[model samples]
Target: MNTLNYLHLDEKRVADVVTALHLLLADFQIHYTNLRGFHWDIKGHGFFVLHSKFEDLYNDTAEKIDEIAERILTLGSVPSNKFSDYLKVARIKEISGVTCGSEAVEHILSTYGHLIGEERKVLDLAAEAGDEVTVSLMSDYLKEQEKMVWMLTAFSSKTCGK
Candidate 1:
């Protein structure tokens, strides 16, 4: 008898994917809050550009958060909803009261770095579970976030040693 989930993935592998998904959900929640803070608090010469960008980021993250929760449900797991739970599972910490545009951007980059790493782990887990839906979703997120990281890195003053 095959011990597979309704989605046809191995039950154990589905459990692992669900665990990673919960972590990813927590990370997105933290990131969403930070983006909102940056949107509201940003000030300086780059304020106009960064303020709008932060709004866009938070909006996008909100959609991703919904998608993540729905995906968790599809995997037969419950998505965590409380902020306290998010704080416990998220690798990214809450960033508050950051007014400087550069500082906020730097924090955004760092948060994205954590998210990218976590997404990679989830991608691998989904692949192992033969979960094509999750694999596709994570792949799309990775592609978009990798571009965001590149663009944000370029916007910063720091440069790779030439």
Candidate 2:
């Protein structure tokens, strides 16, 4: 394919941003799965509440995952979605076994905090490298994660009080 290049971007910088974004996507996939699991397994008096919340969160994650992957594509990089790829790239761990609704809420809060930190780092790197698109994408993601962290933390504190 012969195409005239109009935009000049640093290949190395783009690669770095893509790498970081891929990692973020992987982490989101794992978190999305965890949310679904919580939605499925949640019980007790808070079942209705926890189920609804988890579904909403995971649905949003699904949408964000698509957007992140598209941003990676815009940077001329492929978005990885294989299970092995996610397992290798994700920094977050998948929790197993039974836990209460309150525990699920706490888990989500902690995960959201972790995501916020990771996204902040990615956004800073993109900014430093002049990758405005990636920086903007990460900034939006960070805001959403922060909101989730606050909401989940508030729920755990108010309802569980633990």
Candidate 3:
């Protein structure tokens, strides 16, 4: 039987999983901040509609940030809390002053793309390590994010008209 940091996973596998989780955590942090910016700065003809939508998106991202950190701890590793660390590891960059509704929606879709990609990597790692908890988490996240991506794509199309 393999053991890692008093857990039942192989040490190397756990390390790999922890690394992936940390990367995901960083990506989520960046995405969260970008969503917050969108919520606060978004303006246009759709202000009334997009404002509330951005609020909902940021709130959901905040919850995801907490969930990712908790999962890291569950894997016997510390989650990086520094914004600097997040910037370094995240594929998503900080966005600011995005007032246009279509621009914000486009950025949201791009951020989700990065997030889904990272989650896929985590899913693969978790499955290889037989870590069903992480696997389930990633799977659920992927499903939610993919649907969000689809919705955002439709929203970004010219049909929505900024």
Candidate 4:
């Protein structure tokens, strides 16, 4: 029996938090899986560079997933991890079948862009509801996602000579 009083979460706030948790988790899973694909099948002039970059990105994404799940638990709610659960909650579409390296980047850029937009929505929702923890988590997460989106998109352009 815990003596401390747990915070009372409003119904709407809880729902929003759950939605954001699931959405962020989905982003993490997609990024992690896509990075693995890029690392394995990168057959370009910049294979080594891309491989190392993807490795770092995937590792960081895995850490964020753990942190996001822990934050959800801190709110006394379970974070969803089942494939079915993710599929239902994730705003990002899964890449079907086989895709080449360059094609993978296309999918990643589109999905990452979508995730950046979704993170903004979650951040706004948290702020409006006065959920400081969720707001802080989202603030940090959004910055990282923005940087990743920039890097991922840069690889799709002429600046990288791709």
Residue 128, model 2: Cα distance from true site in angstroms = 1.2
Backbone collisions counted per model: 0, 0, 0, 0
TM-scores, each model vs. reference: 0.92, 0.89, 0.91, 0.80
For candidate 1, report its TM-score.
0.92
Q: Candidate 1 residues 79-158, lDDT tens each?
A: 98999999987889898999998899889888888888898999999999889888999999999999999999888865
Query: lDDT tens string, model 2, 3-113?
Result: 113336676766777788888899999998888888888888788888898899999999988998888877777898697889987988887553589888888887888
Judged by TM-score, which candidate is best?
A: 1
Candidate 1, superposed: residue stretches over 4 Å from native: 1-6, 158-162
Q: Which ten contiguous residues of candidate 1 have the minimum total lDDT?
A: 1-10
Give the residue spans of candidate 2 off by over 4 A: 1-7, 158-162
Q: lDDT values of the candidates? A: 0.90, 0.81, 0.85, 0.72
Q: Which stretches of candidate 3 lie over 4 Å from their true place?
A: 1-7, 160-162
Give candidate 2's error at residue 162 in angstroms: 15
Task: Encode model 3's per-residue lDDT on 1-162: one tens digit a residue.
Answer: 222555677767777888998988888888888888888887768899898988898898899889989888877778988999899878888889999999889888888887888889999999999888889999999998899888888766775444
* Candidate 1 clashes between residue pairs 3 or more apart in a chain or in different chains: none
Model 1 sits at a Cα RMSD from the real structure of: 3.0
In the range 1-162, model 4's lDDT, one tens digit per residue, is 211125545656566776677678877787677677777777767677777776887788789889888877766667887877777767666654433556766776777678677767877887776677777877887788788778777776766433
Residue 144 error, candidate 2, Å: 1.9
True-vs-predicted CA distance for residue 17, candidate 3, Å: 1.0
Q: List the residue pairs that clash in candidate 4.
A: none
